[model samples]
Target: MPTLEVNFLGYRIKSPILVASGPASHDVKQIPIAQEMGAGGVVLKTVVSDKFDYMRYWPRPRYKLIDWDKKMNGKSQYFTLYSYEQAYSGSIEDYFKFVKISKSTSNIMIIGSAFADEPKDWIYLAKGIEEAGADAIELDISSPHKPGTMQFETHFIQAIKSVVENVKIPVLVKLAPGPDVLHQAKVCKELGADAVTLCNRLRGLEIDVESQKPILHGYYAGVGGPWAKYYNFKHVSEVYNEVGITISATSGVLNWIDALKYIMLGATTVQVLSAIIVNGWETIRQINEGILNFMIEKGIEDLEKIRGVAARNLVEPDLIVRWSGEKKSGPRNVFDDW
Candidate 1:
């Protein structure tokens, strides 16, 4: 039998599929559910500092599933999860208690997620999370719903530095999906971060045509779909190529294939949320089963054998064969010479 076990931040997990920080990971009650569903770990819902207290109150009807009913081959296929959901809807103290209780009750790895602007606040939250017995801490600097004008340059660098310095546990930095991702990942590595979570959801807006207004709370919301994995896949591959930091790929993993794609592109683990929201908790178990079956068929005993294989094998642009631009007839690949 093939094993789904993978090591993340030096901690062994039963599977590489972690429940991403979102509504599915907001409550302590969800911990046992995730473990039972065969998830390796859960990045607890991001908690904010007291200064960002207003982020705790999310608007009612915050979730909207756009194009969810679209299907192919008699199966629901694509969707855009647009949401205005913010940080964990609780005080920092409440979050501390939540982490403490979850850590005590759950056998699976529990990582506490936190978002804050100031270095002091970052240290405070990191200390609290460490005190709560979390196995690790992930700095949620790239949350789409982050407030005010906190950029990675002026704001997050110091906070990340402080958190890494203050915490005894492994520190993972969750970065946004943008052109600067590789640079930010390099910075995380230089600052002593143990890992980087490639790509958070992009901030986006949807409008109602009839009302001629923004839909769902009249504000821009975090947006992601299955297509998101493509760019993040590129990001993971590039970051893995250049920065070489541990990566926990997230944003658009909907199945075992998606999970395997991340691992192939150099991700140590894959985080999933939108899939669970749409497909139910069984999705985790299903993905684990799918991966195990694939490994067994491939005659592989461990996942590490395939990790980063695709990234390492990427074809350089200069080496790619290009079409000769001589009015070619019939069908041919863009890279194929006429």
Candidate 2:
């Protein structure tokens, strides 16, 4: 009733709530249920260049995530047991088929999440997704797990440029949180991306110190928790401060407060995972309802009004005037003698 429509490139979504790219969006059957549960849109689990790998398995292509804490809803690290490039992802036939079906009925857009082997492969992936009838293509450049799975900001610019060049449809570059995020967004915009999904899973590790074994089959995984909320907001604020880019805020968006904080920090939409895994899919409706009610109470009608309201509130050396704050001591440059 609150009219929560938002933009995904040129396309329109019923609300700002989206399912983050994960195990939840593997096949066609899950699509209907996700929509019924009030998902504004659902990004398909990343499609890699290796269509042969996907062909070996049907709708239930399986991957495992390591529990950092090994506790449900507890502190954890999630890494794809199996990984590949998402841009040129999956069997082209099945990827196209999923897109065609998802966009047919519901207002929810089918965003194909793609990772490619190299720059040349991006255009094929983007054009393929657009031709396949997806509303948009989400280039997953920021994800921690890929064929090489290297540091995020380092390779992001090249990845964005390649994807934006190849596709005529709206291209969304998912970026990780870091000092370089603002520059990365500018690069995406300059290269002609429509939107930016912020803060990919942060790198973290879990060791079985007792057994002296590694918990994850991979070296490290992305960290997720209730604690990630503030970090997400900070990253979003930085992007909003530097320029206006359509942002999909991610990480630990667990409550209405966390969602509102992101909106105030200029996120166009908020994606969730850990909460849905913990509470249930119905949480979307509740989150939507809560956000809508708060907006009305605070005199917010549209999504843009609250974007970056907290940008000026960010902590900076210039902003802190308190004399009681951490006082500077003498420089410990004793190594100068060496």
Candidate 3:
């Protein structure tokens, strides 16, 4: 079998398949299942400063699918997508118990996903996570569902800056893909973010025109799934080449092809959130199996070799060795050349 190991956010893992921060990773019970199911890493469900503040271990909310490409600027149709109206809420003490149980594995990364409403809250949570035996921290400053919930790159740099000053472990800031993506990542690095996860979610909504109502109960929510992959791919490519921080591409990544494309484009490792929701935890093994098969076919033994391989090709598009390319003029017979 081809070796599928990869280094992400300064830690080497058995594979590049990481479970993104979501309800799937909210408890210690899920962590072992994730590892047993062949996940390369697990970013723990986010822990907020408030423990038992609102609710405790709320059941993972269900997702509502809407046409992902309903408003695409061009030819694409039928985006596999959904909206999450619910967000997890737990107290600090419950999260600590979660961390303690997740630390049993020496290799699987137990990443503490966290956020805060104030600068002091950020610092306090960072210190707590460091002592909680978490391998690293995924600073989730980019959840689009709760608009004014937590202060991240755009709303409040000071909060992130506070956490950076307080933590010694690797910290990754999740951000949205936009013109300011590079700037956001740069700012994160400037404030001591070890790496940047390309996006949290794109704020979008699906509405029932016939019923004249919003499809989700939350009024609006972050859009995710395979449909978001193209935009994520472009954003990741731009950041990899333009910025110096390590990038973890998320959003819309569903298969090994999507994962491989992200690796070539400069993401050190990619994450799967919505795909996991749709496909279940077993998806990680399938992803690893596909990645290994591809690597073996290419006579490659490690996942690291393909990392950022695509970034170098962006400058010289004609120099690409395998995949065929055509100058995309517009919507006109784009597939005609194929």
Candidate 4:
């Protein structure tokens, strides 16, 4: 069998499929479930400091699924999710326990995730997570539901530098998607981040036109789904072409093919969330098997053969020649032309 192993941030992962930090990884017990389902790693839900408010308005954590058809019973080929779920509510100590226990019991990588109210709290939590025996630490600075988080963009490099300095394990930053993604990726590399997750959810809002109000507690929410894949792929490819930072592509993977597209665009691994939420953990094995089967059929021995191949050869848009052919004229009706 062709080897499916991949090297990510000095650690060897069994596969390039990792469960993203979200509801699939909200509980410690879910880690083993992900492992059993063939995931190579799991980023635990964002562990916030005690002072960070975890509560949401009544009827919070709501979701509206946009389907290909109006009836909403169609396939998820065009699925899109708009949601307003907050970060993890439990204390840091509780998350530490989860990481420690999960590391002991499962062979898959247990990446501890943290986001705090203050920059100092980030360092404190990073130290605690490293000590708890996590395989790596993911600094979640991209959560849209948390206000005042992205406002620290000016200090992001400094904050990431502090965590990288404090932690013994690899440090990765989960960045928000925007025009600044390439800039942020370069900054993270210069600041010593071992890897950069391409993005979290984009902040968006939906209107119930009849009610003349916003959906989900009448506030802007984070949005993602299958439709977002191409956008994420473009960013991943652009960042790889620019700085070549180790990238964990997230936000729009729904199947093995989607995962392959990200890998081709230079993603070290593809973190899946919306797919698992809709299809369950079995999708993990399905993705893995699909990749393995494709590799064997193509006589591909390793993922490196295809990673970033497309990005490396990408042509500049400005260099392309535009079509200037005259429009063809035809008779108004087929019978008249005959």
lDDT of each: 0.92, 0.71, 0.74, 0.85
lDDT of 1 by residue, 87-171 (tens): 8998899999999999888899999999987789999999999998999999999988886488999999999989988989999
Per-residue lDDT of candidate 3, residues 1-338 (tens digit): 56777777667788777888887887667877888877778888777666324433332343665554464556234455655633346568677767777887535877887766777877878778888888788877777655455444445588777777888888888886665787888788888888898887877777788889976463666677676778877788878887888887888777788888998888877788777776688778888888888888899877667777887667556665543565455467748659
In terms of lDDT, the best-performing candidate is: 1
The digit string of per-residue lDDT tens for model 2 on 6-96 reads 7657767887888888767767777887889888888887776653254234322222344434654664433223322223234767877
What lDDT does model 2 reach?
A: 0.71
Ranking by TM-score: 1, 4, 3, 2
Cα RMSD (angstroms) for every candidate in the order listed: 3.3, 5.6, 5.8, 4.3
- Native-to-model Cα distance after best TM-score fit, residue 102 in candidate 2, in Å: 1.3
Candidates 1 and 4, the one with greater TM-score: 1
Model 4 gets an lDDT of 0.85
Which one wins on TM-score? 1
Over 4 Å off in model 3, which ranges? 51-62, 67-79, 85-87, 148-155, 316-338
Q: Better model by lDDT, 1 or 4?
A: 1
Worst 10 residues of 4 by lDDT: 52-61
- Candidate 2: list runs displaced more than 4 Å: 51-90, 147-156, 216-218, 312-316, 323-338
Which portions of model 1 miss their true places by more than 4 Å? 323-338
Comparing 2 with 3 on lDDT, the higher-scoring candidate is 3
Q: State residue 11's C-alpha deviation in candidate 1, in Å.
A: 0.5
lDDT of 3 at 114: 77
